[model samples]
Target chain A: MRRLAARVAPPTATFLAGTLLAELLIRALGVSPLLLPTPSAVARAAWSYRETLLPALASTTGAVLVGLAASVALGVLAAIALAASRWVERAFYPYAIFFQIVPIVAVAPLLVIWFGYGWRAVVAAAFIVSVFPVIANALAGLRSVDPALLDLFRLYGAGRLARLVKLELPWALPSLFTGLRVAAGLAVIGAIVGEFVGGGGLGVVVLGAMRQQRTDLVFAAILHASGLGLVLFAAVDVIGRIVLRRWHWREEIP
Target chain B: MRGSPIVGLAVLLCLVTAACSRGGPPAGRVALALNWKPEPEFGGLFEAQRTGAFRRQGLDVEITGGPGAPIVQMLAAGQMAYGIAAADEVLVARDRGADIVAVYATYQTNPQGIMVHASRGVNSLDELFAGEGGTLAVEPGLAYVKWLRKRYDLSRFQIVPYGFSIAPFLAEPRMAQQVFVTAEPIAARRQGAEPKVFLIADSGFDPYAAVVITTTQRVRERPDEVSRFVTALREGWRGYLEDPGPTNREMHARNPEMDAETFALGAVAQQPLIEDEFTRAHGLGAMSLERWRVLGEQLQELELLDQEPVAADCFAAF
Candidate 1:
């Protein structure tokens, strides 16, 4: 209980303090709700529009999960291939960086044209924005394997697959999770951008509310989007903790 | 204490810079924020700037372009002295507690419509919506979309969000997307697609488009300035209708993404919408109480507005 409280206290205190200050400042300044809604107003709007917002949340969640999964699967496979050959990395790594650097907004229209506007385009957006981090981090981890370990595996007559499964894969787990944590957040952003052009999900909700000038509802939708991101981040963190708790160097320290 | 001199110098420099940036003749130097980028949709406003109509009126107007800017909010907050918006947008803004009123209307008829492939052979909104299911690209949460849903059974159609591009519509034969009559339709034609447009106005949801709006406070405080601005705008529009060559060239330079041909097309397309029978009789940028009341009631029916806004409060017809 003490440990959990210590972990929870700071964030809770900061959030509460920030909300209180904002509420008071808005009230004191007589700020228009159109310009800025009080936190309570946003909460109220969220609750009032729960039926609509919840479904939108689920839709966005589906896109994020699918996109993240694709990113992990493809990213890991590409990283493994790159690790096997320096020529492969040299040939493909620039394109991976290109995907990362290309602005999602600029390509979103083309995504709609190619993917035909729906979950496919949205998922593609999420995947493109997110896959680079996973590849970069996983390749770094796979490459960082100690030469001594490779020699040991070779001496034991282990082949590439066996060595990767027994040695490099386990070693790269922590780095892969770091990439996942970053990708999880990016997937949400990409999904929203996709929805901006491709249609569907909370991005549509945000766009609609913005057009109508419902700032309170816009804040509510944004809060829901952030909540989705947090959930994804937390899920990744929990998975990482579970995987790494037994053998990770950090776990062995304390 | 030693750092105070530097801070003071900085503050003085900022003031000097601010004053220099506010350069113009000693008159009412005001800014007009456009809801969209420079297009012939705002030809008259551009014409006013290019032809010195605003200058002649002793009002140096700086027109800033944006992509779907929150004009009503900006005006209500006094960030800009004038803005361009649709009449329905002005009513919606007023309903949301924005104290902005439309002063002059550029497009007497709203240009927003649905673009369907000519091959579809669809004549009206009803036939299109009730036909075999296909994608209909529209901006979600628009009051007109809600009105259409209420007025027709749109269950057959898959409504996707419109991304302000005609490429999708051109690529998909079954797709019908919302368009500004002067914009996407023209682009579609240029790309070798003959699209049949069904104006939303024909469906009895018409609202004046490209209306010049300002705060109610400004109307109350500076009536002469408002009058002069409206007069200049009317003259500018008249000048544009006669020959939009200069304004189109200037606007094209400002918005290079739109090629010269596209700008010329838009200039020709918006002429009929700007100069209608009502505008002909009542002079340019004319508005009516009945139109506002009808629009407010329609919005109220659609539940887009909390209540039917008073028609009088929505605009001041000059």
Candidate 2:
């Protein structure tokens, strides 16, 4: 309990201090709520609109989860195929990089045309934005197997399947988790962008508030989105620690 | 050597500042931020700028255009001297504590409407709402949608969110979507789709469109300048209606996404909406308090506004 408290204290203190300072600054500056609502006003708006906001949160969370799962499944499979041979990596790696570089905003409208303006388009957007990191990191981990260990496995007459299951797969776990963490944050962003273009989730809430000139509500919705991203990232981090604890115990030590 | 580099940096900065200020408008210059991209809806503003109507009024005006900008906030925050918005938007902004007042209304009737495929056999909004359900693409939280819900039974339609695209409507014969009467109908026609538009104004929910707005502070502090700007705007609209060829060419040059043909079509389509019997006697860009009051009441009935805003306070007719 003490350890957990110590671990939590710094961020808690910083957040409280920062929020207080912001409240004071906004009051001192006499900033208009339409321009920038104070933190207190944002909290009030959030509480007042919780009935609408909670459902929007659930809808966006569903899209993010489905998109992240699809990316992880496809990304890991593609990485394995690429790791099987140098020729495969040479043929397909550039395409993965292409997905990473293309801006999602430009592609979101096309998704609407294909998926017909609903959750499916949003999931496709989230998947497109987040899959590249997983593939890249997992491939890097698979390729970084210790040469001496590989030689020993070869000397033992282990076939390709045995070598992969025992050596490369375990070696790649940490790097795959790193990629998953990055993809989790990206999935939230992609989902929001999808919602912006295709309409559903918190993006619509933000758009409606903007059209209504409800800046306080806009700020409230943004805070909810950020909270969702943080929750997703923390879930990935916890799962990574648990899975890595057996073989990669030292790194997991607090 | 270090001091010499700093000296060179200072010289560069001075040169940049000189270039920025040189040949620019004078200190008294005012700017108008448009709520949408350059199109026929903003034809009169472009016409005024091209023909030196503003310069003749001794006012140097810089007009900037973009899609879905926060025009009311910019006006309230003093980022721009004037902006273009709908009368409903101005009222919503005032309700949200932005002290903006509409000075001139461009379209006597709102141009927003529902565009249905001609084959859908949907003649009236009632038929569309009451008939067998089909997909209707619209922005969900707009005041007009709420008003429509109160007045009709829209439960039959599968209302999807409209994202300013006509692709979905073109692809699906059974789909209907919201559009500006002056805009998407033209684009859809060019793309070989026969689209029938049902004007929302005909449903008794008309609010003035493309209203020229400014901070109430500006109206109170500089009434004469506001009057002059409105006068120049009226003359510009008159000229545009008389002969839109020159102004349409210039606007097309600025916004090449709109071809000359599209500009011509939009100009012809929006003419009747801009000039009608009311504007014929009251001059161009005229607004009445009764219309503002009715709009406010409608918004209040829809529960979008906390209360009915005072009609006189929402606009200043110079």
lDDT of each: 0.85, 0.85
Instruction: Residues B1-318, candidate 2: write the lDDT tens digits.
Output: 111212322432343334333433356899898877789999999999899999999999999746655677566556678999988888888887888999999999899999999898989998888878788888757778877889889888777677777888999998888889888999999999999999999999999999999999999999999999999999999899888899999888888977888898999999989999999988899999999999999888876775569999998988
Docking quality tier of model 1: acceptable
Q: Model 2 off-target regions past 4 Å?
A: B1-26
lDDT digits (tens) for residues A1-254 of candidate 2: 99889989999999999999989887786666676778999999999999989999999999999999999999989999999999999998998898799788777878888887789999998999999999999999999988999999999999999999999988999889989989999999899888877778987787677777777888798899899999999899898888888778434534
**Alpha carbon lDDT at A13, candidate 2:** 100
lDDT of 1 by residue, A68-119 (tens): 9999999999899888888988998888898799888788878988888799
Q: Note the clash tally of each candidate.
A: 0, 0
Local lDDT at B216 for model 1? 93
> How much is the lDDT of residue A233 in candidate 2?
90
Give TM per candidate.
0.93, 0.94
